[model samples]
Target: MTRPELKTDPKYDDYDYPTTAPEVQSGHPGHTTPEQDAQVFQLRTQLEQAGYKERLDTLCMLRFLRARKFNVDLAKQMFIDCEKWRKEFGVDDLVRNFDYKEKPQVFEYYTQYYHKTDKDGRPVYIEQLGKIDLAAMYKITTGERMLQNLVVEYEKLADPRLPACSRKSGQLLETCCTIMDLKGVGITKVSSVYGYVKQASAISQNYYPERLGKFYLINAPWGFSSVFGVVKGFLDPVTVQKIHVLGSNYQTELDKQVPKENLPKIFGGTCDCKGGCALSDEGPWQDPEWKKPPKWEQPSKTSQPTTTTTAPAPQAASNAGTQAEIKGAQQAPMGS
Candidate 1:
């Protein structure tokens, strides 16, 4: 099957948003190659034959294929295992019916939140591992409940977060920008939560492949590098490459990728939203005024008629023309 093309709208010409190409960029950490694409097609065909096609889309199939490096058989098995887990876990019902009434209380001890978007239009997820008091956390919510909440959040990321981002940027966004803050962390803390972290990592790596675009590990305490060196052994090289381990001096580096206004003040930024940055959930995707129309409703430039007067010009010139038209339209009539 040929790769699908993303539809672009001329109406969005003046919008200053990052654009991603339709096909996955090869050699990129989270992207798939042509060989992988072919394998994805083969896997999809097989899944369709087996009546599992409805459970996966091209993006979803490509994730499994990429997770196993385009090994069709292995990818298929991985996907099958994931489906089995989903059924047993009651993921669909959880997504619809599960509610964490203790979320606010949980957040007080363990910070896990989808705050905003990064420069690339991917959602920004922050998790302060050092703040985790598992004993206190479990007092309010069980381990099973926490995992359920994680799964629900993952579902939201796949749906509204990514789709909204795709609409806003006019591109296919499939991953998130993550900040795993390890401030005040030590060997004891790491060891204490190793099991839970390992389980969460396995779920993300196995079931939700290619969903991490950039990972920043800030406030690395003493000996954290050596500790990470041991941990990295269990992770894929691609996954390791996407992670940036930084010391307390992370502001300058983080500022390069994330806008100061969008970042939380606690993490060395300017913004301090009403409730809090972590829960503010502020971004183009979340803004009612800036949100893009759904994919099916968005008018593609190619589908619309182009007249001599309305033909698209060079990008810079088109933007200038659009601005001028808007300025003229908005200007009040002069008094005679």
Candidate 2:
């Protein structure tokens, strides 16, 4: 007797860029087991029965399932709660219209931005927390606005950024490689930022799950171990495994994960954008060949088609173009 055949998405074969075989075979969309496939279908049905009108795609469902360790009931509840939170948070409206007009001002005090991709073609998001001045940042923009901007950025990542990276790298990229700088962070600073950090961590772990690919905490100061002990309570074991705690001598390890040419100079890399890495928002997502309007901005069927450059199909098992997960911007570690 033959064993069951692994599932695969045929569309990926013809995509302009190839989907990495590993991603397909790692229990994701293209290579799910029969049982896992059944779970996805069941979750979708339950969601539809419960009146979830959006984000019912296979990839979206799988992320929630993985977050809950593939427990269908738990995944269903997670999806329901996420949908409810999206409604209450006015996520749709925020995605379409919310803009961080004070982004520059906020960046001056607390830097959090996506710069480029890492070795595995995942986007590299950098957060400079050592110098964060919550008091000064709050004066420019309230914590409420900061969180709103975080959500908007996450939405963009799911659509244009990840899709563009997948197309450019010939692979399906969903998560991000993060660098959390902790050079100047101290106990006093940690306490000062605890409130915002807690709120941000809750949002990332609860609403957006399984978006973290690699996490690095560099320039860890003394007494970081004790702080990390408390921080671990907020993160699950899988997420904790993804994290790497590095001391001031982090350049070598960081370079091993991220190519020096793509890394920022501050992190002992050579890349220095004309303006600054934080504000540049530079990546394949902005590349003319790959960038396009996000899913939310796409014209409706009633609207006439316009001539414009189009991006290749995002070949994941997605129907509504819905995908988003982020532990981004949270940068929640022992310090800062």
Candidate 3:
């Protein structure tokens, strides 16, 4: 038979699909144990089979404390890597996820972390609704001139108003998490939090808030201090009443915007209803408190500890336990 003619246009070769594994599997004896590529998944299974449950948990803690998200694969791989790191000599606190829960909350799983500093004059660290970059971690691990410089750069990116865990502006972020999905835009900023609610809300109004509902107060009360850092007793009930009245009938609009799975439950306080609290007891700030509204546990935390240190303790204290050794070395003779 004549050999298959080679096409000069090369469509057949270009259209070719290559396979590293066979398409068929058979239970017949002596199949020669498949091939090397066929055993590719074996390493993952072995790593899983090795099963360092505690080690894995610790890794999850590492990611959490360092502002990492947790998922099953990560929990497992972190366990393996932590063990490997210990064997290689970088041992200690293989887990410390900045929290105390077995599984992180969904909001915790999907929020932002700030690495921003390009537009600042002071050191700040901010977290909100987003992700963190473990590979670029500058706290301490690698020892290089560039890595050293990064620490200085990060200091400027920090925000005085933000928290390490970063609080939301209100239920606004929870709203975005719910509404944006209906429009098909996935929020990816690690710095997204309550602080950005206005910006996101503005975007929603022009782009998708019509699907959500009316924005109750359009940039009200003038300053963020008007919301946070103030006593609930001092809050003006009327201002809140107006906002509630403005967006009161939001459900009909929500039904149109959200996919059924993303439907928001009627939040008594954090509810998507801009109308005020859904618990008939409160109609607006008129109910006497957004501070500890009904159906919510834990009152609002409007202030931070006055004594909390904004920056890491001074270098002298940072090396507290090792201070004696460090001082002795400095005093040692050059030749001795």
Residue-wise lDDT of candidate 1 within 1-336, one digit each (tens)? 654442222322232333344346652323545665566668877665555524455556666766666677777777766766776787666777787889889888877777777787777778776777888988898887877777777776765567677677767677777787888777787677666655565556556656767778799888878976876766566656767889999999999878887789889888898988766767666777556543323332231112222222221211122222211111100000
All candidates: TM-score: 0.76, 0.82, 0.17
> Backbone collision count in every prediction?
0, 0, 15
Choose 2 or 3, whichever is better by lDDT: 2
| lDDT of candidate model 2 versus the reference | 0.70
Ranking by TM-score: 2, 1, 3
Best by TM-score: 2
lDDT of each: 0.63, 0.70, 0.22
- Which ranges of candidate 2 are over 4 A from the true structure? 1-26, 226-237, 299-336
Model 1: per-residue Cα lDDT at residue 298: 33
Candidate 3 lDDT, 38-71, residue by residue in tens? 2322323434355422212111222222211223
Best of the candidates, lDDT: 2
For residue 49, what is the lDDT in candidate 2? 63
TM-score of 3: 0.17
lDDT of 2 at 92: 77
